[model samples]
Target chain A: MRLEEKFKKLKQEKKKAFISYVPFGFPEINMTGDICLTLQEAGVDAIELGIPFSDPLADGPIIQKATNWALDKGANVDLFFEEFSKFNKKLKIPIVIMSYYNPILQFGLKNFFKQMKSLDISAIIIVDLPLEESQPYIKEARKWNIDNISFITPTTSRLRVKKIIKYARGFIYYVSVTGITGPRDLSYSQLSKHIKNIKQNTEVPICVGFGIHNSNQVYRINKFSDGVIVGSEIVRFIENNYCEKNFLNKLKTHTKNIISR
Target chain B: MKIPNDKGYYGEFGGKFIPETLSACLEELEIAYAKAKKNKNFVNDVNFYLKEYAGRPTLLYSAKNLSKVLGLNIYLKREDLLHTGAHKINNALGQVFLAKFMGKKRIIAETGAGQHGVAVATVSSLLGFKCDIYMGAEDVKRQSMNVFRMKILGANVIPVVTGAKTLKDACNEAFRDWVTNVRDSYYLLGSVVGPHPYPMMVRDFQAVIGKESRTQILKKEKKLPDYLVACVGGGSNAMGLFHFFFNDTRVKFIGVEAAGFGLNSLNSASLSIGKPGVFQGANSYILQDKYGQIKNAHSIAPGLDYPGVGPEHSFYKKIKRAQYVSVNDKQAVAGFNLLSKTEGIIPALESAHAIGYLKELAKKQKNSLVVVCLSGRGDKDLDIVRNYNGIKL
Candidate 1:
């Protein structure tokens, strides 16, 4: 199902959407499929599979280290598709591929989109691609019925928010902080004000990310926004427990703990 | 000669391709720069610093000895004589002036060869603003003298040890800092790379080199030089020298990129072999693998050890306005030695790439008037050169 349909279904069920992120080849290349399944079974509404790039300016040190390790483990665009294809058919939740534009451009946009479409990927969130430069990609992705997500930040002006939401699809990613993605304290009052302003402009579901670590943060964000995205915290957990005997169980436990709130 | 379009595109090569958090900051900078460009008082302040502090209108000298050897009337635009010993001061001074105008009390910058770092530090100290410079750990060791120069000038040099341990990694770190500190901090970018206003602004500040060279050459030779040449790292010096003569169809432009071992080997000559990709915010010619991961670039000159060129250079190359070529480490070393011995001048390894190209151009273009931008002095490179020659400096 398309992301919009899934959001509508979740709205009917009255369950807050829970999103989780993991680099495609993090911890180990072969473990990506298992990780995604664990996230799905742990009650994540969607999965954001990060395609590792050499320079990830939007990521924190933890994700940067994971990406570098993934790259060293021979992760590439093709490798991601190969691994993702393995379990995409069995996955129930929508999957969004988050990547920097360079890899997609290098992989050939048409081919990359075709591969994503074939694998039943729901959307793509290109971190570095702002609205002014996203027309071509958005137009192309639309042809494959793939949603091209747009990001709105705390620093984004109201006028820009209106302009961005006009082209926003799948969902709007609301960066909870004014910095690279990592855990930090969030002002619940300020966040509510920002999301309220954004909600006035569009009916699309708004997802809050960046600096969300524990269940309390997720619960607070879920109250103000339609969805909560947990990335670096999960990546950190995977990093800390990848070699442990009950790695999957621990990761699933942590994932369930955050969203269960 | 066409400037970037309204969206900051130079024929699809330049744009503000950063994340959402930086959008407002970049917009603020763009608005401030636009206002500053037109404000007479701001213009006067920058020009005053250019003349009195950073040594503007630097001399254009006839390299008599080198000219005799090359058989061409070779003239050097003496940016090497500018304060901070390179053309980087031109941009650094202008940006710091803008930062002060905007009420930013702290500045952050990224450096590869340390010239830009030193220049930024010099201006920050002079302007009494706190400064932090991110440099690759490898560059910190390779250009230790410059690292010391920056430290003495009152800038904190942060060594970045990630991803190839080079310029690209340093840039990544600086971007990380700017995104985190966007409210009160100014990112004083050093080259004609990065997002929109940066390529445009840095080119404008460094355009003084071309402006002075144009007038000086006209006064001295009674005509514009038949050719212009400069080294291209992120292409500040080349853009500084070439922007003025861009419309002069009679004047040929050449940019020399460092071919570390050779172009076939791991090298920094992005314009020659790299494919077009977005990196460090600009869509330019970048060395990347088929899967789009940036490749590690190598060069004896730390300043030239980058896998990408300025977006403007990519536009110029596409329009056939300039010719881009590569010179290996050996040729650059030879160029360094030749200039020191024949002219009593020690050109920086980055600048020597331009001089190295002149050897070939001189052979074919005898009797022609040619101007090369001697971008920097070689004092910081003395140790590297000495090490290359098996001598301790």
Candidate 2:
């Protein structure tokens, strides 16, 4: 199903969407599929798979370490697709790839999106691609029925937000802080006001991410946002517990604890 | 002569490909720069420093001995005589002036060769602003003298030990710092390679090089030089020397890149072998793998040991406005010794790359007037040169 359709279905069911992010080939090459399956079982609405690049400017220390580890283990775009094809066959929820733009450009934009269509990938989030430079890639991604997600930050101006939302698809990612993804305190009053301002401009569901760690934070964000994205916290958990025998159980428990709120 | 379009692109190169968190900061800087460009006081303040403090209209010397040897009338645009010993001071003072105008109290910069670091430190000290410089640990070791100079100038020098331990990592660390302190700090970007207004602003400040050269060459030789040559690290020096002459189709421009071992090796000559990719902020020719992983770049000159060039240089290369060539470490060292012995001047390893190309240019064109931008002095590179020659010190 399309990512937009899934959001609509969640709205009808009166449940807030819970999205989880993990770097592809992290911990090990073949473990990502099992981790996604565990996240799905724990009530994640969607999965955002990170395609590791050499320079991930948008990420903090945790995500940077994970990506470096993945790259060191010989993870490449071709290798990611080879493993993801098998994972997609058994997955029911939508999968979105979060990558820097250079990777997609180097992989050939047309070929990358064509393969995404064939693999049933639902959307993509290019962290560094601003609205001004996204026209050509957005045009190609639309041809494959793949949504090109747009990012809005706390520092974004209202007029600029309107321009961004005009081209936004899938959903809007509201970065809760003016810094890289890591644990931090949230200001709900300001966040709520910002979301309300954005809501007046677009009809798409807005999901807040960055600095979100626990169920309390997720519950707080869900009060104003349509969904919550948990990234560095989950990757931090995987980094700490990947060697444990009951890694899946720990991951499942962690996911359930966050989503149950 | 042609500027980037409204969206900050130079023919499919140069855009603000940064994160959304820094977008507003870039917009603020762009607006500030636009306002400053029109403000008479701001213009006067920048020019005052360039003349009285940094020493503008630096001499254009005729290298008679080297000219005779090369069989060409070679002139040196003496950027080395500028305060802080390089052309980096032009951009450093300009950005610091802008930062002060915007009421920013603290300033940050990233450096590869430490020349830019020292330049920024010098300005921040003179202006009484809090300054912090990020440099790779490897560079701190190689450029220990510059590190001391920066500290003595009252700037904090932070050694970055991440991601190949070079200029690339230093820039990444600086970006992280900027995002955290975006409210009170100004990122005094050293070269013409960052997002939006930086490439344009740096070029504007450094264009004094070409402006003076144009007038000086006319006064001395009664005509425009047949060729203009400078070394390309992030291409600031070359851009400074080439910006005014860009519209003069009769004057040829040449930018030399540092090929550590050779062009085929893991060299830093991005304009020669790299593919177009977005890095640090701008779209430029970057050395990266097929999977878009940035590659490690090697060069004997710390300043030119970067994996990417300025976006304007990439644009110039694409349009064939400028020709880029590379010289290996051996050739650069040879050029360094030859210039020191013949002209009684020691050139930086980075500038030596341009000098190394003169032999080839002299062979191709005889009796032509060639202007070479002596970008910096070699004092900072003395230890490296000494060590390479088996000197204990």
Candidate 3:
């Protein structure tokens, strides 16, 4: 299914989508397929499979540890896509491969997009590839019908926001932070202003990330944007609740309560 | 041939394992470093600063009586004579100068022993750029003198409180700041570890040690010393002295790591006991577990307590051009006292590791010439050692 359609489906229920993110094959690569299946079964609106890169400056220690574990397990583009390809048969959730441009450059962007498309990845968010420098990749990815998502932050001026809006497709990732992603208490006033600014600048669905950790942030996030992305917390959750079959069931019930409210 | 562009990988030791957001910053730094290293103007400008500002060609004084007592010919490279009393000034001057040339308006670095912090503050003071230094809370408390010096020099010393409150935590906090403010800020890493261009770039800047040592040692002895010794924390000073001798089979390089109580006790000897693993985005020997989790590194000397060594040191050790030994805190303190009274030079606690090994080398090898890198002065360490020694000023 198209990436936007998944968000649309969530909007039909008048609920903000829960986009779960995890470093693909973290802790160990062997557990990736299981995690993907678990998230899919848990009714996650979409999934961003974090392709672990060696130098992830935007992540905190928790995510950094997750990436390190994934990298240590020999996680790379080839292996990531190889493992991701296994999910094409069983998982119905739209998978977006999240990574930095260095790995893409190393893998060659054209080839990387091609591989992403071939592996059935519906979207991608290159965190460092701002709209100004994304024309070539966007154009190429467009040809394959893969969604090229863009991001905006509190620091982004309206002029820059318009540029991001112009290039944005699939959905817009509205980062609630003016800083790197991590665990922090969100200032409701600041987050509301950023959300309002993004809504004014873009026509696409907006999903806020970078500080949404628990059910409280998830409920608060619904007032600002169309969806919420919880990355570090979900990784933390999986790490803390490793090997428990009821983990997914509990998370699903918790997420359902947050969104339903 | 072009050097590798990867910022934090050293024979599988250094690479960027940071968030996706900072990859572009690391890439930009990699490009800037490559361009600067190749530029003749940059090279000549850095050379001029080394000569004029830092007082290059610091004397290689022969410790005749001390050598006689130890039964070995020990020579001091005397980096303590440099403007900042440590070799950190070499890298700070090189990088801060590069930042100015690159049009960066701010300088940021992390300090453990505070030598690098003061060195960075010195360069920033001279260059007219805003400077920020992240030091561990523990280090700030211990090295309060250097903390005062940095603040007096107009650099903000931010105390980092995370993960044992030490050098590694300070580095993490600095990197966190760099990712956010990298557009106008240049991260002047104090050592030769971290990702790619850093190890190579720092080694290039401090390579002046090897360059000057080559000319000085040859002029004085008409030959190289049998062994070159320096203390290793992140291994910049040792690498600086050893880089020139890497290809020279005639000279042997020795790196002394702090053993705390001893290697048998808690200490930070990543090179001595660590296996190949990745941390903070570089590949080299690191203190890590079987699952690749970074373990806590211990050492009484805050400067030598780091969990990893520089990439070049790892490379040199792999090729067998360099050897590393661990010296305990008790031995290092004794070495510090011996050097101070015997030679009238107050070596930094970190540099005392080199002296500790020198004492052992003097007993084992008779009439052998050795060049010991006096990497820093001990003025900042006086308070810590005074309390440890139970002596009033």
Candidate 4:
């Protein structure tokens, strides 16, 4: 299935996409497949598989800890690709790889995107590759048929929003706050105003991310945005519960609670 | 000499590879910095502070004793004599003056060896702006004196407890702060690293060292020095001295990097053995694993303990305009002791790396004049030195 079809399908069903994020190799490379399967089983529309980077400037403490823990356990791109290749045919939802630019840039963009394309990865979110430096990634991603998910923050100027939506693919990641990825008490009315402002400019579906943690926030975001991207909150939970006896069960319950009923 | 090509690329190395949240802020900074360079009052303010306050035209002392010991004509650019005990105050005063110009109330920075942190704190205090410094927790423990100095200077020193607890992590935390509070706070970046305007701006602020060195060298020796040397972490002091001589084809540049254990072992020798990659916004030679996870940089001198260097340094390396070498921790400590005993100057461990390399350079030629930038004073490093040599006194 194409990346846009997922959003179209969700829109036709009058439902919002509940995209749950899990760092691909949070505990270890092998554990990621199981974690994704569990999240899928718990009823997520898509998986935002975060690749562990040494320097995640856009991340907060929770995701930073998770990334460090993942890296300490010997997480590498080859292992991630090998693991994902095993479960590629089985994945029911789209896999959007969220990573910083360095890891993939060093991995060789051509080879990395080829593997991502073969694995049927729908999109990629390079947190550090802002629009100006994104030309190289955009060119490479287009050739490989991978959707380039761009970010639109509250701070993004109106002129930039117009420029971004012109070439925007898959969905626009509407950063809910001006800060890094972590839970924050965001004003819904203000967020709604920004979201509506962005919505008016683009036909591309938008998902609100960064600090949307609870069912209440999820429910509120679903009323407007096409999807809700739950990142640091879920990563924080796994950091606390990854070693628990019933980790999968806890994750399922936790994920189910946040998805709008 | 002309670089960054309007889009800020120093030979395919530096660019504004930042986040969207900070894009407008960076663009604003770029425009403001461009104008600030042309603004007569801004230029006067920076020059005035550099002259009247930070003690510009620091002595180009001919180190005759050290020169006789190494069998080479050695000249020392005594940046250690500057206020705040390093060349860092030059950039700090300039950046904060710009912050004052732009009406920013808060000034924030990241530090490794604490020289830059102390400099920023000093300037922030002098300028009466609210100040916060992010230093690695490990650095806070090591450079405890500098930490205290920052606090007493009326700056909030925030310890960064993430990612090897060193310079890189502190930089990450500082970027997070800037990203969050970019509107109200001015990120007074410490070195010639980071994105576009930072490397260019910091170098411009610090170019006074080279500017002064050139004039002083000619008056004393009747010719430009054959070689210029300075230690490289993020390459601020190095760039400060090197950029002015870029057009002086007769002069050669050498950047000394800290080889913590050895280049083969744990080290911070980015230009020596690092691969080209992006980290902390700029594309530079970064010490990383094959999979691109940035490796922890190790150095006894906290300042040079970074895995990445300035993009401009990488450009110089690639274009063969400059050469880079490494000195081990033991060699650096040896350099520290040799300079103290021979010249009565205790060089910072970072600067000692360059001093240590002089022994190697002395072997190549005789009677050639070489200038080494003593980038900072070594008072903050006394604890580390005592511990290294097991000296009770």
What does candidate 1's lDDT look like per residue over B15-53, in tens digits?
988998998999999999999999898899899999998
Candidate 3 ranges with C-alpha deviation above 4 Å? A1-17, A21-43, A46-57, A60-179, A183-228, A232-261, B1-16, B38-41
Answer with 1 or 2, whichever has the higher TM-score.
1
Candidate 4 reaches a DockQ of: 0.82
Please tell me how candidate 1 rates in CAPRI terms.
high
- Cα lDDT tens digits, model 1, A1-261, are 578988999999987889999999988899999999999888899999999999999998989999999999999999999988888888998999999999999898899999998898869999999987888898998899889989999899989999999998999999998899888999999999999999988999999999999999988888879999999999999999999998999988999999875
Could you give the DockQ of candidate 3? Answer: 0.13
> A24-101 in candidate 2: lDDT tens per residue?
999899999999999988889999999998888878899988999999998889999999988787788889999998
Q: Summarize candidate 4's per-residue lDDT along B220-302 as a digit string, tens digits.
A: 99999999999999999999999889999889999999999998999999999999999988999999999999999999999
* Candidate 4 chain B: worst-modelled 10 consecutive residues by lDDT: B1-10
- For B266-384, candidate 3 gives per-residue lDDT tens digits of 78888898766556656578775443445667776788878888877887778777888888888888888989988888899999989978878866778898998999999999987
| Reference-based lDDT, each prediction | 0.93, 0.92, 0.80, 0.91
TM-score, candidate 1, is: 0.98
Per-residue lDDT of B268 in model 4: 98
Which pairs of residues collide in model 4? none
Error (Å) of candidate 3 at residue B331 is 1.4
Off by over 4 Å in 1: none
- CAPRI-style docking class of model 2 based on DockQ: medium
